[model samples]
Target: MKNYQRYTKMFSMPPVRSMDWAEKTCVEKAPVWCSVDLRDGNQALIEPMSLGQKVEFFKLLLKIGFKEIEVGFPAASETEYEFLRTLIENDLIPDDVTVQVLTQAREHIIRKTFEAIKGAKNAIVHVYNSTSVAQREQVFKKSREEILKIAVDGAKLLKKLADEAGENYRFEYSPESFTGTEPEYALEVCNAVLDVWQPTKDRKAIINIPATVENAMPHVFAQQVEYISKNLKFRGNVVLSLHPHNDRGCGVAASEMGLLAGADRVEGTLFGNGERTGNADIVTVAMNLFSQGVDPELDFSFMPEICEKYREFTQMEISPRQPYAGALVFAAFSGSHQDAIAKGMQWRRDKKCEFWTVPYLPIDPADVGREYQTDVIRINSQSGKGGVGFILQENFGVNLPPKFKEAMGYAAKDVSDKTHKELKPDEVYRVFLERFVENRPLFDVSECHFKQLAGGIEATVTVAEQGKKSVVQAVGNGRLDAVSNALKKHFGAAYTLTTYEQHSLGEQSTSKALSFVGVEGDGKTGWGAGIDEDIIQSSFEALCAALNNLFVSRGKD
Candidate 1:
């Protein structure tokens, strides 16, 4: 907090205002997605992926429905060059997919790049040069004219080589540090390259503007993009692409705004894997569209599978809070969040609604291969009754009575707090069982026979306690009441049967009935549960369990 003068803004705004992009509320369509995982993502890893690993990742990109993938800078390394050759020779590149390779504006690298894609059916020979003011003054020691010629010369050479090789290879060029370059100068250099390539309608060229190092707010970048989109020559015959990094944590924001600025394509990696803070996450951008009712054209329906493969190939761990693909993205551990989510899910089911309007969840977990029972309502010390009850009903078909859910929630929360860990669904069930269900400590009913009477039903109840047995008879308004009266009379126990409820466990011919009972005594209450094939027997067992809990609560057991 004391080092106030240590930091300063590193980026500058464009000289002109391009506020048209700001009027758009959201991206109305999915952009052409290009996965740079094999190149940009792999190069940033501490241990770059092996040749086989790169191949595996290339296949994954195809599976995810990426039509254009930046395979690698083949001319940069033997592994990269051979990886392209391997894909070409093995026929791994699909006919519909076009592979893109990166290269500097230098000649030998460009020549070797052509060699690397010698037999490719379709490829984009991407070339780039730094055009920023710092690169001109500090790194390249060249004038603005010199940098502009570098891009022009490279563009001319790529077209000539593609012509000689008799291959219809498309071309792409990037002003490497577009964000740092003057917007007017950047447009001039891009137009110079466009003049050389003479891109046509069928063979459209790509002019990728990369935020090589993010420097300013996202709106500034959007202004820069709109400038290029509006003023560039051959705009209709060009694919304006964006490649933003996350130095300032605004890659996704910049990319979205860039699309609104009339850019046609995006280049990013899964989970934002790239140099430094990483590239714009294609997964996040695509899922953002999917949540808005636009089909992203990417198959994230098996996100868990894709995540697993990504981890195995990259040797990188996906953050637990990564949007849409993380383990805990859909999980609600807060009491209030769980309660709202539980009520929302029940509302949907009750109304048989077709739309996804669940509280706290932007989209249904099931839509992305996540289970609500396991992934949505996680139990912890902060969990509440609705979540606890939802876990029971969804997982094991054991629906707790609404009044009893509070007690069940307290039992689960206490166990989780004492253990200092979250309770799984099965653990929650076990806590419920140990604390409330079949709790017969004071006495166990060996048998119970109900007889019809003029005033009410009479019950002959046999009780077993401490290896001793006794039989007693009583009358009440109902069979459960008669049993409760008989037990209280035999043990001199004084309690009021306050709550009773039952439901069938399943819809089978011999479905078991589950009963819940609550007894109030000594200014406190006790709860119990019982399940049996016969409803009357289940109610009798429920009464016995309640009596035992009452005795335990009174310190009389």
Candidate 2:
């Protein structure tokens, strides 16, 4: 903070009032996604990937629907040169898929780069030179004309070599560090390179604009991109591209805005893996379009598998909270969030809605191979009744009554709080069984027999309490009421049956019945659940369990 005066804005705004891109709201379609993972991401890694890993990553890129991939700077290292040769010698490059290689605007590097892709069916020989004012003044220490000549001479060499080799190789040029360069000057250099290539509709040339350091905001970059798009020569045949880094954490935003500004392609790495902060995340950029009802043209349906393989090959860890792909991105732990999500899911089931309009979720987790039970509504001390009930209903076919769900939620949360850990679904189920289903510390029912009467039922019940058993009889309007009366008489218990509900656990006729009961006694409500092959038996057990809970609440145990 004290040295803030030492820093100044290095980015230059475009010279014209090019604000047409601001009228667009979102990226309407997918861009030509060219992955630089092997070249940009691999170089950023602490340990660069082996030749085998690079090959596997290339295959992965092909599977993910990339038409253009920058393999590496083949002129930079023996490893890079050998990797390109391997792809060509083994015929690994597909006809439809174009492999791109990078080179500086120098004759030797440009020649070596062309040699590396000799046998490839389709390849883009990408050439770049720094055109930023900082690079000219501090790094290259050259004049503007000298830099323009560098790009033009390299373009001429590319054209000459392709004619001699009789290969229809496409050409791409990048004004490196374009963010720091004057927008008009960068356009001048790109147009000069385009003049040398003289690209046609059949073989369009690429003019890439890179935010090498990301010194400005996304709107500034979008304006600059618009200026270049409108003023560039061979405008119809040029494939306008953007390559953005994440130093300012706006790589994805800048890429999106640049596309809206008429850029046709994006060069990035998966998961934003690159030097410094990393490159723009192609996954995030693509998924952003996918979430907006645009087809991203890439298959991320098995995101977990992709994340695992990416980590294994790169030896990098994916954050648990990474967007769309992290472990916890879809996990809802807050009580309110879980409750809302539970209701939203029920609404979908009831209405059979075709659209994804669920609250608190921009996209359906299931759309990305994640599930509701395990991924959406997770249980913790902060979980609520609806979430607890949802877990039971989804996983175990036990739909708790609304009032009982509150009690169940408290019970599960208490366990999780005491243990200082999140409760798994099975652990929550076990808690339910221990507290509400098999809970009989003071009393148990051995058997019951009923006899019909005029307008009521008479029940003879065998009650076991503190190692003692007794038979008590009472009359009531129904079997459960009759049993309740008998128990109150035998134990002198005071309680009212506040709630009773039952449902079949399965669709089959012989499936077990599940019953829930709630008893209000001593100004408090206690709940219980029971399951049996017979509905009557399950109801009876439910009543007994509820009364037992009441007794414990009243300190009669």
- Model 2 compared with the native: what TM-score? 0.98
- Tens digits of per-residue lDDT, candidate 1, 1-557, equal 97978967655565677879999998999999999999999999999999889898898889889999999999899999899999999999999999999999999999999999999998999999999988999999999999999999999999999999998899999998888888999999999999999999999999999999999899989999998999989999999999999999999999999999999999999999999999999999999999988889898888899999999998999998999999999999988899899899989989999888999999888878999888999999999999999999988788888878998999899999999999999999998877787677778999999899999999999999999999999999998989999988998878898999999988898899999999999987888888899998888777777778778878895
**Cα deviation in Å at residue 310, candidate 2?**
0.8
TM-score per candidate, in order? Answer: 0.97, 0.98
Question: Which pairs of residues collide in model 1?
Answer: none
Measured by TM-score, the strongest candidate is 2
Best by lDDT: 2
Output the TM-score of candidate 1: 0.97
Task: Please give the lDDT score for candidate 2.
Answer: 0.92
Worst 10 residues of 2 by lDDT: 548-557
User: What tens-digit string does per-residue lDDT give for candidate 2 at 1-557?
Assistant: 88999999998888889899999888888999999999999999999999999999999989888999999999999999999999999989888999999999899998898888899999999999999999999999999999999889999999999999999999999999999899999999999999898899999999999999999999999999999999999999999999999999999999999999999999999999999999999999999999999999998888878898899899999999889989999888888888898899889999999888888899998878888778888899999988898899998889999999999999989998999898888988999999998999988899999999997999999999889999999999999999989998998877889999999998899999999999997797888888999898999889888887888887886
